[model samples]
Target: MRQMRMSHDEPLLAIDGLKTHFFTREGTVRAVDGVSLTVPRGKTVCVVGESGCGKSVTARSVLGLVDEPGRIIDGRIAWQPGAGEPVDLTTLDPKGERMRRIRGGEISMVFQEPMASLSPMYTIGDQLIETIRLHLPLGKEEARDRAVEQLRRVGIPRPEERLDAYSFQLSGGMCQRVMIAIALAADPALLIADEPTTALDVTTQARIIDLLRDLQAETGMSVLFITHDLGVVAEIADEVVVMYLGTVVERGGVDEIFHDPKHPYTNALLGSIPRMGAGAGRRLATIRGNVPHPSDRPAGCPFHPRCDAAIGGVCDVSDPPHIVFGEARSVRCVLHDDGAAVGGDFRVDGERA
Candidate 1:
C-alpha cells in the first residue's frame, strides 16, 4: 500500500446496519443480517464464519452483485473520499457509470472461485485490458501496459506469456493471481478479497497470503478479507469479526480475539484449528454439526443448538445482544449477558482467562 495522507477524520469504508436477504421457497434467508464494520485506510479487517454465514454476501452487497430474489434490503456503505465528505454507495444509481468506476477503481474485489469468476472465452490479457480500461481513462496501449505491470506486480511469472493464456490454460493459483492483477490495476482504495486462497494448495495459499500482505503494505489500501479459516484470520487479519449463522457474534483486535475469545462460536472455531506437528494421525477437532439450514435455523441464539454450554434454557428462547467489552472488544453471547452465569471474563473454550 502506497503512503496516504492519514487523518483523524474517518474510515476509508464504513458499513452500517447491512442487511441482505433472499426470498426463497424455504423462507427469507438473512444472508447478512445487520452487519456493521469499518476498515481504516491501509488496514485489514477479516470476516470469518462457517459456510452460509453471509461473509461473501456482505462483500457482494458492497459491490452491488446481489441477484434476483436476493438484494441488499437495508444498510449503508459509505466511502470517505478525498476530503471528509461521505459518499453513499447504496443509494447511487448502478448504471450511473460512477458505480462501475468504483467497482474496480475505488473498491475492487477478488472473488473466491476464479474458475467461475473468470471468463474462459477471453484471454487473460484481454480481460485485464478490458478491466483496466473500464476504470482508467487511458488509451488501449497505456491500459495494456498498466495491465502487464499489474500482472507482474501480482507475481505472475512471465506476464507477457501468461496474458495470452486462457483461464483454463493456467492452474488454480495462476487464475487467482490473474484475478488479483485485475483488481490491482484498478487502484482501489479498498479491496474485498472473498476467500482469495481457498482453491490453492497449502504452499500456494501461504504465497498468496504473503503477496497480499506485501501488496497491502505497499499500497496502504484497506482490505476486507472473507474466510471460514480461523488460521488464515490469525495469520493475516489485524482485526477479526466472528459470525454465526447470519450475525456477527464477536469482534475485536487480533490479539484479544485470539487470546481471549469470548463467544462460544468463536472459541469453537479456534479450537478446531490443527496445531503444528500434531500430525494427521490425531483426529482434528471439529465444530460438530453443520451450520443450520437457512429455512430451518434455530430460534433464539442461532448457535444455541451447537453450543455445549447451553443447557436448554433462555439461549433457546432469546437472541443475545451485542455488548462492548473494552475499548475494542465486543461479543454477542448470553453467557456474557447482564452480569449472568460466568461473568464476562469467563472463557468460551477454557483456553482464555
Candidate 2:
C-alpha cells in the first residue's frame, strides 16, 4: 500500500459549498446545497440525517457518481493524495481517466444496497478480481488471490468457495461483506459507506460496523459514513455532521452532538431515538413532520416550520445565521444569534464571531 504523506493537522478530504442539483421538467431539485464538511485522516465522520436529507447524494457527489439530470453545479472537493498538492475533484470530468482512477482506486464506495450493487450475472470472484486488477498491476491469478484475501479479511466464510458464488446465492449480510471486499480490494485511502448496514439485521449490522472499524485501524483509511442511525453514529463517529433539507444544520464531536446539541433539529432528532429503560407505556418521541421536497423547499430557514424554538417572524423571513463556537463546532440557527439565545454573534459566512 502507498504511504500517505499528509500531516496530522491536514484533513484527508475537504468539501466546500457543494451544490448538486437535478434539472427536471417539474422543477430543479437541489439535492445537496452548500454542504461543507471534512474527513480527517484515518477517522470516521458520520453524516447523520433523516431520509431525503441528501446524505446519499452528498456521498455520491464526492465520488462523481451523480447520474444524469443531476449535476454538481457548484463546489470544491479538495482531495489530498498525501504526495502532491491537493486535487480539486469537482473539476475533473466524471468519465475521464483521472476521475475514474480516483473513484475506485483512491476513494472506493460501499453502496447502500449490496445486492443491487453486485451483479448477479457474474460470480463474486469475477467482480472482485476485476476491481483488483483495475487499480493494481497484478496477474489474473494474483488478482484472484487478492480477491480471496479481501473476502477473508471481510469475514466471509469459506473464502475460496464463496468466490464463485453469485450475489443472489449469498445472504444479505454476506452480500454486504462482499461489496465491502470489492470496495477494499485496492486499499482506497478513503471509503464512502452509504448506509451500508441499513438493510442488515441488528447482529449483522453490529458485525459490519465492527469490521469496518477494524479495517480502518488496519489500513488507516478515512471513512465518510452516511446513516440515519444515531446508534451507529455513537458507535463509530469521531465527528458528527447533522444535515437537514440539503444543508448542514449542525456539526461537532460525537459527544458534543449527543450531550449538548444546539440546533433544534439536532435536539429533536436525538429526542426521537428510542431510549432504554423508559416506562412501559411511554411513547417514543418523534419529529413533527416529513422532510420537505427539494423542489418545494420553504422560504428562509428550511427547518423553521418544524423547529419548535423558531422565532416566527425572524426564522420564517430570513436565513438562519451560521454560528461557530470553536474549530470543529458550528450550528445554523436563529436562536444562536447574538443576544437572541446563545449570545454568540452569528455570521452569514460561517466564520467565528
Candidate 3:
C-alpha cells in the first residue's frame, strides 16, 4: 500500500487506486474500480457521470458506509483531520470508534435523498442537535442553539419553529436545507454532497448551489460534490472528475474539462448539455448508448463502443493509460496517444478536440 505523504499544503483528502466492490449472488460489482482523485483544501471537486457510474459509491466509501455485500477490497482514502497528519481511511474499521469520530465530525455528508436520510420519526431539531452535540462538547441548550443557528444560516424561514417540525411536514426544499444544516453543524473539514439538488425545483436548486458555495467560502471547507449534470458541475466545480462505468476517464480544472476536453466521453457529455440560442427546431444531442452494467462491462476501454474516435483493434483491445498533461490535466483514452490527438474532433459549440 502506498501511504500518502503529508504536507501543510497537501490536499485535504487523497484517494489512490481505490476499489470498492459488491459481492452479490449475481457476481462481483466493481462499483469503484481503481479510482484516484484529490480534494484540495477549500475547493469544490465535482464528480460527473450518469446514474450507476459509481459516483455515489465513491462518496459512500469515503464515509465508510459501504455495507453488507459491498467492501473496500483495495486502495487507500487518506484524509487529514484538522491540521493533523494524514490517516488512511480504508484501514480504519467501518463501524469502529475512529471511523465514527471521522464520519460526522471531521467529514460530513449531505446525502441525495434528504427525506430518506433524515429520520422521519425524529423532529428535525432533534436530529440536528444530536449531530451538533456528538461532535461538539456543548450542553443541551447550547447544542439546540447551534442547530437553530445553522437552520437560519441555511435560509430556513422561522428556523426556531421549523426546528421542531418533522421531515414529512416540511417541503422537499426545506428538508434539503435541513440536511445541509445537519451536515454543517459540526463544521467539518470536508463535505461530500451527493446530488444535493436532484429533485429540487430550478429556483430551489439554484439557491441550494449558491448556499453551498457561500458556506464553503465562509467556512473554508473542501467539498466533494457528485452530480451528473454538466451545468451543475460548471456552476460549482473548481476541478472536475469525469467517470464512466466505474473509472475516471478524465480529470482537469473546470475550464479545461469544459473548454478543451481530451476524452471522447467528456466531449459527448458536454455535447449532450442543452445550449441556449442555438436556433430552434433542432433536436438535443444525446450519448447514444447507456452506461454498461458493472457485471457485463466491456474489455479494454469501457467506452470504446460509444466513442466517436475509437480506433478499432487498439481501443477495444488495450486499456489506455492515464496520460497526464500540463496544468494537472489528464485523460484516459487511446485517441490522445503519445501526448497527441490521433483524431481531432470538435462537438461543443466553441471547443475542439
Q: Which wins on lDDT, candidate 1 or candidate 3?
A: 3
Models sorted by TM-score, best on top: 3, 2, 1
**lDDT score, residue 315, model 2?**
82
Looking at model 3, the pairs that clash are none
Cα deviation at 53, candidate 2, in Å, is: 0.5
Total backbone clashes of candidate 3, pairs 3 or more residues apart or in separate chains: 0
Q: Give the alpha-carbon lDDT of every model.
A: 0.84, 0.91, 0.89
Q: Which candidate tops lDDT? A: 2
TM-score of each: 0.92, 0.94, 0.95
Whichever of 2 and 3 has more lDDT, that candidate is 2
| Residues 1-353 of candidate 1: C-alpha lDDT, one tens digit per residue | 11234354678887878888899987898888888888877889999998888888888888888887998778888777467457777877666787877888898999999888899999999999998888779898898788889999999988888888999999999899899998888788889999999989999999999999999999888899999877888889988988877788899999888898888888888888888999778998887788987667788889988887763667788888778887558888878776555433555674324
Best candidate (score: TM-score): 3
lDDT by residue (93-182, candidate 3, tens digit) is 888999999998989999989999988899999999999988899999999888889999999999899999999999999999999999
Worst 10 residues of 3 by lDDT: 343-352
- Score candidate 2 by lDDT: 0.91
Report lDDT (Cα) of residue 45, candidate 1: 95
Query: Per-residue lDDT for 1-353 in model 2, tens only?
Result: 12234454679899989999999999999999999999998999999999999999999999889998999999888899685667888888889999999988999999889999999999999999999999999999999999999999999989999999999999999999999999999899999999999999999999999999999999999999999999999999999999999999999999999898888888888888898899799999888888999999999999988876666678888888899999999999877776555335533322335
